[model samples]
Each structure stands twice: as C-alpha cells, then as structure tokens.
Target: MPAEEGSGIHCRLDELLADRGMTLTELSRRVGVSLVNLSVLKNDRAKAIRFSTLTAVCEVLGCEVGDLLTVARRP
Candidate 1:
C-alpha cells in the first residue's frame, strides 16, 4: 500500500546536497547550523525541522522544501 502523507515521508537533504556537489561541511557553514545538528537532518533522523533552519537551507541551496523531500514507502 502507498504511504500516508507525513507518515513515511523522507527528507532528501543529503541527496540534494550530493547532486549539487555540496559537502555537509559547506552546507553547515552556509546554513549556520552545527555539523552535528545538520548531520541529524542529513541522516534523516531529525524528528522535525525548524522554520529558521528550513529557510536557511532554502537560502543556501536555492530550493523549495518540495525539491528536497519526498514521500517514502512504509515498511
């Protein structure tokens, strides 16, 4: 069955960064987030995202949230 909205959704922050040839270090520097905190987002372990952090990421990467995330299948 298909996943429900926000149920099995996944973030693609790491993938988008990679596709753009950006390192997590560079993104952390640009986004004003610590490497460790950003790693949580990058590794898809973040329970939620702050609006400020989301804005920072959008600013740095020039992408809307939709461009960096997708709904994933549930197990």
Candidate 2:
C-alpha cells in the first residue's frame, strides 16, 4: 500500500553513524549543525529537513540521501 503523506519515512542516522563509528557530536561538528537539531533528526522526530542540511549531512557521512531517509513498506 501507498504510504500516507509524511508517513512511513524512517531516519537511519543512528544506524549510519554506528556503522561509521561516528558520534552525534562529531556529525554535528562536521556538518555544522547544532547537536540539538541533529538529535531531533536522529531520533526521527523531525517533521522536515532542509535541502542544504541534507546535502551537508550526506557529504559528511559519505552517504546518499536515500541512505539517510528511507520509505518503510506497509503490508
């Protein structure tokens, strides 16, 4: 089934960071984003993200946008 708008999107920030042996503070510093703001996105509580932020994060993490956000399929 098709996911409702703004639903079923999952953030993989924590997992990606773990896989890379990186900390939230490190990412915050590298991406030039505040820890609190990155925490919101890390915990999947962010309602939206800016394109600039996304690009910065992807660059720091060496990942594509798809690696950061993914669509979860519902049965």
Candidate 3:
C-alpha cells in the first residue's frame, strides 16, 4: 500500500543504503533491527522510530539523523 499523504516523517533509508552499497537485509543484521521493521521504515510506513534504533542505523550507515529522516510538510 502507498503511504498516506502527509501522515508521517520521510525516511531516506533506501537511498542511504544504496549509496553505501548495502541491502536492507545487511542493514537489519548490522543494526539488529528486524527486516520487517526496517522495511516499514524504508517504505515510509513507520509512525515513529526509537532513538536507539536510529542511533544504530546512523552509526552503521555513517550518517546523521538528518541524513536518514526528513520532515514532510502537509499541503
């Protein structure tokens, strides 16, 4: 299903993973996040993210929080 319009924050996980030549499965293993959860974030279906999970992902991807997430404005 498509993400709801202006419903949640945008996650750049797919782009960052591609730029680093990493797959979602690889990231899931490295960051200790479940593939399903990661997929949710990757597809912009997540309503919230834990700080620890965010930190782990950022550490593995060599990116800051801003690099992984962005605010999507409602029209």
- Which predicted model would earn the best TM-score? 3
For model 2, residues 8-39, the per-residue Cα lDDT tens digits are 77789999999999999999999999999999
Please identify model 1 stretches exceeding 4 Å from their true place.
1-7
Ranking by lDDT: 3, 2, 1
Q: What is the alpha-carbon lDDT of model 3 when measured against the actual structure?
A: 0.90
Estimate TM-scores for all models. Answer: 0.81, 0.87, 0.87
Higher-TM-score candidate of 2 and 3: 3
Error of 3 at 10 (Å): 0.6
Worst 10-residue lDDT window, candidate 2: 1-10
Each candidate: what lDDT? Answer: 0.80, 0.89, 0.90
Estimate candidate 2's alpha-carbon lDDT, on a 0 to 1 scale: 0.89
> Residue 7 of model 3: what lDDT?
62
Per-residue lDDT tens digits for candidate 1, residues 1-75, read 114434455778888898889999999998899999988776666677899998899889989988876767666
- Report the C-alpha lDDT of model 3 over 1-74, residue by residue, as the tens digit: 22364565788999999999999999999999999999999998887789999999999999999999987665
lDDT of 1 at 74: 66
Ranking by TM-score: 3, 2, 1
Q: Evaluated with lDDT, which candidate comes out highest?
A: 3
